[model samples]
Target: MSRLKLPHNPKLLSHWEGWENATVYSTEGNSVLVQTVDMITPILDDPYDFGQVVAANAISDIYTMGCLPELALNIIAFPCSVLPKVVLSQILAGGQDKAEEAGVLIGGGHTVEDDELKYGMVVTGFGTKDNLWRVGGAKNGDVLILTKPIGTGIISTALKAGEATLETINIVAESMKKLNNLPVLLKNHKIKINACTDVTGFGLMVHALSLINKSKLGIKIVAREIPIFKKANELALSGFVPGGAYRNQEWASPRVIINATPAKMPFDPILLFDPQTSGGLLVAVEEKNAELLLNILKEAGFSATSIIGSLVVDKEERIEII
Candidate 1:
C-alpha cells in the first residue's frame, strides 16, 4: 500500500539521506553519535507495561549503534477520548520508569488527538565512530547473529484479535522489553562484526536487505538456526500473522528469496518481514569471534541469541534464505 501510493499528499523532505552522507564523525567523550526514536500505539493490555516497552524500545537504537544516551524526548499521539485519563497516566508512568531504568531522561514531548495510540522515546547518545556498527560492512564469511527471538508481530496481532494466549503475550513482551545492549559489551571483543541493525518493522529480511544492498552481498540462513518465540510460528501458520509481515514482503520482494519449500516452513517468509514493535538486533560478525560476541551478548542478557546466517558477495544484490 505504501509503495504503490502516497499515504497522503507526500510533503517535501529536507533531511533526506542525512545519515548516509555523514562521515568523520566524533562525539563528546569520544562517543559515536547515536539517535533513535521509537513509538507504537498502546499494544499491551497493561498501560504501564506499554509505556515501559515503548520507552525502552525507543532508546534501543542507541544501544544497537553502540552509544550511551545523554537524553531523550517522548513522542506520543493518542485518542484521549477513547482512552481514559488513568490509562494515559499509566502509559506515561511506564514510559518514565523504562527511561529511569536505562538511566536516561524522557524530559518531555508532544501529544495530539490521534485515532490510534502511539508512544515511544527519542534517544541521543554518543560513542566513537570506530565503534559504530553499521549494516554496510557485512562481509563474506561473517556470521549473522540475532539477539532475541522473532515473532512479536504475529503474537501481537493475535492479541489484537483476542486470539493470543496470555502466556504468549507474556513471552513476547519480555522479548520486546529486552534492550539490545550488545554494542557496549562488544566494544572490546575479539569478534569483528561487519554490519548491524535493530530488526523492527522491516523484519529480519528487509533490514538484512540494507546490508546486502550496500555490501553487494546475499544472506543465507539455516532454517534451524533462526530463533523464534515458542508459539509464534504456530500462530503465524494459523493465520494470526500481522499486516506488517505482508507489507514487508511486498516492499522487499525483489531482495529476498526463501529457499525452503513452502510446505516445510509456510509462514517463514512472512515472519521474516513482520513488523516488530521492539525486536532484537542483527549483527554480521566474522566467524572467528562469533562465539565471543555471542557470549558478551549473553552476559548483557540476550539469552536467546543465535548465529542465524552468513553473508556472501552477490552481483544479484539480494537476500537468499536457505
Candidate 2:
C-alpha cells in the first residue's frame, strides 16, 4: 500500500533501515533531522487524557532517536455531528499542551468527519551526530534499561472490563501521559546511549529483540528484574490480557528462549509481551555507565526505571528470559 520510493543519498541514514522508530536524515553539518508519525483511537475515558496520551505516544519515536522535538502537525478525525464541538476542542487543547510541554511548535493540522474519533501528530526533531542513537547498535555487554514500568495493556483492558479501581486508572493514566525525555536528560548529563527504542504496541520483548536484529547478539532478561504494575499481574491472571499480548508472544516465541517460569505471580513473565501504549524507552548503555544512567533517571523522578538485562553473544537465540 505504500508508494514510498526510497531515494539514494549519502545523508539519508535511515533510508533502508527497517523497523526503526523514526526516519533520520543526517546533515552536512554533522546534525540529523528525525521524522515520525503515530496515531491511536480513544484509550482513556476522558477525551483530554486520550489526546495527551496520543501526543506523547507520537512524539516518543523522536525522543527514542535522541532528538529534541521541534515541530508537529495535528492529524484528527472526529464525529463532528455526533460529539459536541467542545470535545473536539478539548482534544486539540490537550494535544497542544502536551506538545508545548515538549517544546514543540504545532504549526497546523487537518481534520475530517468520521463516525469515530482519532488523533495523532507528525513530529520532527533535531539532534547532533554524536548524540543520535539507533535501534541496531547495541553492543555485547551493554546493559538494557527500561525507563518505565510495564503493563499498560493489561491495566487498560481491566479498566474497560470494569475491574480496574480508581487507583489503577490514575496510575496507568499518569504513566501513559508522561513523556520519554530520557534521551535529552542523558545527553545533558553527558551519558552515552549505545542503542534505544520506545516500548509500544509490539511490547518489551519484541522491541528488545529489534535491537539485536541481523546480529550475533542476544538479550538476557532477568525475569524478576523486569518491572510490572502489581494490579496488572492480578488482572492478567484473571484473564484480562489483551489480544496484542498474545500476538506478540506468538511472534517472538520462535526466536525467544524462556528459561524461567511465570513464578508465584503466574502472570508476571507474560507482561514482557503485553503491549504498552505510551511506554518507556528500552535503552542500551555501556556496562560501566548503566548504574549512573539508572540513578540519573531515578533522580529525575523516574522511580520505576530498572536495569532489566544485558546484551550477550549468543548466536543461537535472539532473546532469553531467565
Candidate 3:
C-alpha cells in the first residue's frame, strides 16, 4: 500500500504517517479529524458479546488519539443462511449499545453475506491539534502508564481449545468489552500526555516500540510490574498461546532487550508479546505527574492501571525489559 503512487495531501499530519490511525486536518483547520477502520473475527461464542468487543476494539483507535468518537458505520459479514435472523439482530443490537455507551451514533451500516462471521466499525472523531496524541511524542524520563491488563490473546486461544474455564472466559470477555475512555478522565486533570497508543494485535512490546521510533530514546519496562490476567500465563505455558503471539515475539525480539530473567516463571516472555483485543491505552507523561495521573485513573475505576515503564536515552535499543 505504501508503494502505490498516490497524490499527496499536505493537510495530513506527517507525524502520524505510519501510525495505525490517520489524522487529517479539516478544511477550516480549526479542528483535526481522526478516522480509523477496524474489524475482527469472532473471538467469543455469543454473537452479542462478540459485537460488543468488536465495537470497543474499533473505537479504541480514536480514543488512543485523545479524541471522542462521534460517528460510526458498522461493517459486518455473516452467514445468514446458516444462522438465524435473531443472531444477526442480536449482534447488531450489541454493537449499537456499545457505540451508544461511547456517546457515538450508529447512524447506518453495511452488511455482506459470507461463510465466516466478522464484525467491526469505521469510526470518526474530532479533536484540536494541541490536544491530539500520537505515537511519537515521548520524551526522556517520561513515565509510561498502562490502563489495563494484558493476556487477552492467550485467554482467547485457550477458549478455542476448550481449556479455559467459564469464569476465565467471562473475565476476558468483560475486559475486551470495556471501553478505554481514559481520555475523558485525563481531560479533567489537565495532565500533559506526551504520547499515547492502544495496545492491540501488535502486543505491548511492539506498540511501545512504536512510541520511541527514531526519537533517540528507549523504553525500560519493569516486567514484574506488568499486569496479566489470572490464568493467562498458565494457559500460555500450556501451549494455549495464539499464533499472533509468536509473530509479535518474532517482530519485537531484536528490538527488545530483557535485562533480568524471571525465576521459575513459565511463559513470562509471552506476556510482553501477547496480542490483545480491546486493550488499554499506554500513555507517556512526565515523571513528576505520573502518580497524579495514575491516581486519577484509579479514582475513575481503572484499578488495573499501572506505571509499568519509562523512557530513557538509550541509543542501542528501543526497549529494555527488566
For each candidate, what is the lDDT? 0.75, 0.88, 0.86
Rank candidates by lDDT, best first: 2, 3, 1
My TM-score estimates for the predictions, one after another, are: 0.87, 0.95, 0.95
Model 2 C-alpha lDDT versus the unseen true structure? 0.88
lDDT of 3 by residue, 146-179 (tens): 9889999999999989999999999888888989
Off by over 4 Å in 3: 14-17, 264-267
- Highest TM-score scorer: 3
Write model 1 residue lDDT over 184-301, tens digit each, in one string.
5665665665777788877878877777765667788776777888888878888987777898889988877777776645445678777887788888888987888888878787
Residue 206 error, candidate 2, Å: 0.5
Top-scoring candidate (lDDT): 2
List of clashing residue pairs for candidate 2: none
Query: Which has the higher lDDT value, candidate number 1 or candidate number 2?
Result: 2
At residue 112, candidate 2 shows an lDDT of: 90
- Is 1 or 3 the stronger prediction by lDDT? 3
Q: State in Å the error of residue 234, model 2.
A: 1.3
lDDT of 1: 0.75
